[model samples]
Target: MDPQDGYDWQPQQTGYVPPQHRPRAQVPRVDAGRLWAGGAMTALVAALTAVVGLLLIRGVLGIPVFAPEGDGAMGDASTGVLAMGAAFAALVATALLHLLMLATPQPGTFFVWIVTLATAVMVLLPFTTSAPLDARIGSAALYLVIGIAIGSLLSAAGRSATRQDF
Candidate 1:
């Protein structure tokens, strides 16, 4: 006690004090069913995007893509192949997103980067082929559209499927 100020005073105690207990943060949970369902829809959209892009390029624009001009607007079997490939690619991306969500801190950001780089590769792939310049451009544009579709759709799905634990 300080008699002059009429106030109680205490000296600081120094020792090895134990830390206070803290509650651990909960881990975010993911709904696999919802994620997979979104993935399926994304795949369907990707496939359709591929088909429509091909139709627009080949039928409406009269540009040969994935086949010769003599193959007509449908572009032979390659059209179906491209559509299927897009769908498969969507499924694969969805799976990757799922894995990232489970394992990474910012899954969506990583997924976007991965998908964007992959899409860039696909878009540039046509330039490496023996196809004409116009065909390469058209194919590149189509691939870009498909990649955008898949990336966007899957991102939305991932967001919807994630649940924050309080």
Candidate 2:
């Protein structure tokens, strides 16, 4: 009834009450199937790089790259080596890209560019060397084999990583 009572109001005091079980956020689940597909995709990219390398030499450069026409400018052995080496370098680059590109977890622009440049050099290197172009190309193939080995190692590592549950 007093006028002063209307003017004065009191605030309530409360304690924080946390739930017995706090709700947790869900993480986006990654399927194992995608991992296999990713690996295959990477390998295909590498192989295609090798094939394109051969074609570029024949197409863009107008060079008899893979096909052994005559004793090439670099001679047979040297040219073959260069070709194989370039392919190998591409394979290595692909694996490295896949492993190192943690953000993407796949091949990206950097890997492709590096491999492309190396492949081009391998394609063209024999011409400058004393050896024949075929030899250089064959040498390049050898390097490709080495790269394949490196990729195999990386694939195994990827497989192991995927088997782990997040």
Candidate 3:
């Protein structure tokens, strides 16, 4: 017989042997009570995000869903539909974010700041296309700020909620 075969594979001493592969314990479930308010907030935020996304899609696509009474520099069926869609999406996102926040705790001030920025962008999207060349730049800036604001706030809330130990 080979020398290796005669020897035992297991360790000779076993006072305190650690497992080579330890399974991770399951995370504790968050209580429904704890999540109620945050869940609502998260839902709102998600709705807002969706709304903004829809508006952007409509604006670029020029979907003629609605027919304005008369043509105007500011108003058009396609434009209106697009803008409305955007606003709605944002609201939806707002709901989503609200729900997310309900689960997690985070910095409220910073969160709101982001929401304001994204909302501002969506709010001024109509102005974005109709403005003079110089004004267009400003509109773009506004949209950027608003988008960032919304994104930041939503992410912050979500992070906080998810991070909860419970």
What lDDT score belongs to each candidate, Candidate 1 first? 0.91, 0.48, 0.46
Q: Which candidate number has the best lDDT? A: 1
33 Cα displacement, candidate 2 (Å)? 2.6
lDDT value for model 1: 0.91
> What digit string (tens of lDDT, one per residue) describes model 3 on residues 123-153?
5665636445443443454345445544665
Better of 2 and 3 by lDDT: 2
Could you estimate the TM-score for every candidate?
0.85, 0.33, 0.34
Q: Candidate 3: minimum summed lDDT over ten consecutive residues — where?
A: 64-73
Deviation in Å, model 2, residue 89 alpha carbon? 7.7
Cα lDDT of candidate 2 equals: 0.48
lDDT of 2 by residue, 10-119 (tens): 23333322333235544333334554455545555555555555545544454665455454433356445544544455445545654555445443455445555654
Count backbone clashes in candidate 3. 56
Model 2 residue 139 lDDT?
Answer: 45
Who is ahead in TM-score, 2 or 3?
3
